[model samples]
Target chain A: MIEALKQRLSEHFQLTNLTIKNAGLAFLWVEKHELEMLLRQLRDFEGYTHLSFIIASDHIEKNQFKLTYMLHNYDTKHDLGVHVDISRVNASMHSIHPLWAQAWTYQRELKEMYGIDFPESPRVDEDFCLEGWDDMPPMRRDFDTVKYCEEHFDDRDGRATEENRQTMKVNIYPERGE
Target chain B: MNLTHDFSPTPEVDLASGKYVKIWHGPQHPGITGNMSLELTLCGDEIVNCKTHVGYLHRGFEKLMERRTYIQNFPLVCRIAVPEPTFNEYLYSAGIEDLAGIEVPELAKWLRCLNLELMRLGSFLMWLGGASGAFGMSTVYQWTVTHRDYILDLFEEMTGARIYHMYISPGGVRAPLPDGFKDRCLMVMKKVEKLLYEVETTVLNNAVFKKRAIGLGVISSDMVDAYGVTGPNQRAAGYARDTRKDSPYLVYEQLDFDVITATGSDAFDRTIVRYQEMHQCVSLIRQMLDRMPTDGAFHTPTPNVLHWKIPAGETYVKAECTRGEYGYYIETDGSEYVRRVHIRGPSYTHAIAVMEKLVIGANIADVAGLMVSLHTYPPEIER
Candidate 1:
């Protein structure tokens, strides 16, 4: 299947760069990165019609975020999981929604969740969450969810106690710890 | 090049003239069975182009699963596919059990099958309603909804919650066979089977339904394979791809039933296939209740869900949901929290790829009709 897919990728797609890095029976992850020229060539390309998912993973350990486009060429039974690694500090990439309309939502979702900006995408400004007063984008590598929970969410450690509740009263209440 | 759909490119390439108005149908539309939208570019009553936009319903379930412990996600997993929640909890517990090397007792497996099949019937009844409503048959909607509420009541009696019954846990069920629960479930299921037959007379065999659904969303066998369509949608296209039949996790292998398949791969075929499968579910439920095993554990032993370390490994569990193959691909890094939980559902492919291919060249009037005919649960898609 890998050989067939690799041959089909060369025959069907004029890629600026492509490589097969991982292979396993459970799953195979083929890394492919394309420049602007190959991006236009891929538009007219057939067999790569179905798009499974587009995800931007915040690899905190690697200190870089990876944006992956999992495209399925149903015609050839070939799955090309294209990934582009970018620095966490400037997590931005060229959007592919111009080639496929379905990327519009997934790109918008990646931006909303990870604070990654899409430079050349359409409709990326759609609001998924963080309606106003923005803090760190939630899916960022440095978002610190536990800290965010402590600050934004209710830290109900011994929260249901009567004295703690009484001291927590808004008006005419004395400070106390339970 | 891959247009096995057999529709030739328009001789005059209407070219999706910019005059066509693009209408975003949902993410919220009453006509839509769930919170998903189709970007429909329509030229009068004809559809020139169509695209599906989901992810509005994303609850960050995979991300949220990373935060919560396995047990806490039971209540949350119920929200994955609200119409059918038991399967989500069932698969989660099953996956965890498989990882921990905990084998569910034979009785528990059969009981799980009983619950899954009954839920299938209940959920399919809901689908029958929405599928018919797509063609302006409001009565089927009312009929199926009224019938399904009784099943929910049975669920409430068996477990505590009406909708989100987090009854099935990692270690057997949350509670053992409630007194007379089996009889109550059987009675409701028998009544449901009767209502299902009435649905057959009024909706399934109804001529208007045929006109609305038949050949409306004709997905080819090749399209089904290419797009990874599974469950009823795949079966509807004459592919016998039910996980319950193929993998037979739980008690499905023990139970005796034939996999239902439809010939046309069209909207009508999908509806009829689900209708027939509901009958089979009724039979399977009866078989399970008839051979009631009142003696073994319903769940495996589980530790404190929070701070409970799960054994490091990956487990993938799939079941024949009312829609299609409902699966969860989970990865555990030996932590209490999941490393990654890829929630795969039937709607992921059905509402996205298959619908995208089917909607184009179909009449604009038939767009919503085609969607409801597919019977995709939107929350599952977002998950």
Candidate 2:
């Protein structure tokens, strides 16, 4: 079923890197510009109407972020993921809020967490999760959460230093040798 | 598909006009489902605009999972949804298993299904209590909560934890059924069945529940796909889309059941759909216990937990949670830690976009009832 859809999709759109994870799931990459049309076609013609989610993965070394839009077809019980990569330097993508009412929330969250821009999305600039967050987007691969926690949070007097559980157990029970 | 939804611009409301009053509905109120607030703009007891406010309980689980290994994430995923954690554990483990190409044992499959069904019953019980409590029927709340405690007792004996049962781990489950667990579970089921009957008489058949719930927060059929509604919310709208039936995972294909649905798509219909599903859960649990193998290995050995690295791949595994389609999207980088993990809880859409739209033109008194009908857990939304 996915192969037939891929065949139909590749006929018109510039499709690349088709990866079938299983019989019921598949993922394919498309140009950022072709995403809106492709998604409309998928929803209207191919019956992949339910938008499951939109998620971003930061590939710091590649200087790009992979955004996956997961769509589900209830009739076929198949999940087709549309992947689009945008440069991490000025990450922006076309908003699909016009297609799905819930897309704006996902776009808003992506904007807040990954610093990705979804132009004209409703409340895209508003804080979706974090309030008064002055640091870099926390979900980005570059964000060092451990360092931030250590810097912002104070350690208790007796628990200033952290120890590995295995090593601590060995130190507390020296009679039981490994 | 036709793009018929009119994305009409929301009319600006002037708070200075003195005709309107703005109020915060949640974050501390018992009427709210969890620690989430709704900013409502009302005009004489009628809501004109509603905006959902979250992040009160955000633990940043997605970011935290990136620093933890595959095995370490098993226990952490359960915290995403407090009411029903087995779906999280199952989906997280299933996503890992899918990417790592590990086939689970048959005994573990039955056990996972049993755990999920039981979790669904317990979660529905809690929602039943909350739904009734929201409508001023506190008696049903006490009855359902006590029955839910009985289910928790079953969980305590089986998984050694009442709330967060990290029994379903990567590769397979952690243990098998305990001795005489079937009889005790059946006894609890019988008691729950009796409790549900009493609820049907005192709550579902009550005059107040029908008056307040019927024709309230009605979601049209077209909105189901547009807003990404699923489970009972979609089922109540007359769309028989169930993750268990649509894409059967584990032992669901072998289980005999029908997709329960209704046409009203209101708070009352959703409650009825869920109420019927609770009975289905009882049946599924009984079937699983009767057919599961008595002696077999439940756990499948995997690579060392301290240093488990999965090949680079991405997969989205979802299951029919009590609320809706709960899923986990995992991306591995052939490292000890995950590259990216996204927990997709149904509440993310239901509590935010859907609730924001449905609350418009609704009475302030019905806001809590409408929210409870959707059965959202705020922790999952911010996780």
Which residue pairs in candidate 1 have backbone atoms (N, alpha carbon, C) closer than 3 angstroms, thus clashing? B27-B36, B171-B299, B171-B300, B172-B298, B172-B299, B172-B300, B173-B298, B231-B324
Please write out the lDDT profile of model 2 over residues B30-136, one tens digit for every residue.
88998999999999999999888999999999998998767668889898888898999999999999999999999999999999999999999999999999999
TM-score of 1: 0.75
Per-residue lDDT of candidate 1, residues A1-178 (tens digit)? 5666446656644444444522311222332344333434432453555445567666677887766555544344344555567778767777765455445556776787787888666557766433452787776646677687678787667765444233334333333222
Worst 10 residues of 2 chain B by lDDT: B1-10
**Which ranges in model 1 have alpha carbons more than 4 Å from their true place?**
A1-59, A62-137, A145-178, B1-19
All DockQ scores: 0.08, 0.56
User: lDDT per prediction?
Assistant: 0.70, 0.91
Cα deviation of A3, candidate 2, in Å: 1.8
Candidate 2 contains a number of clashing pairs equal to: 0
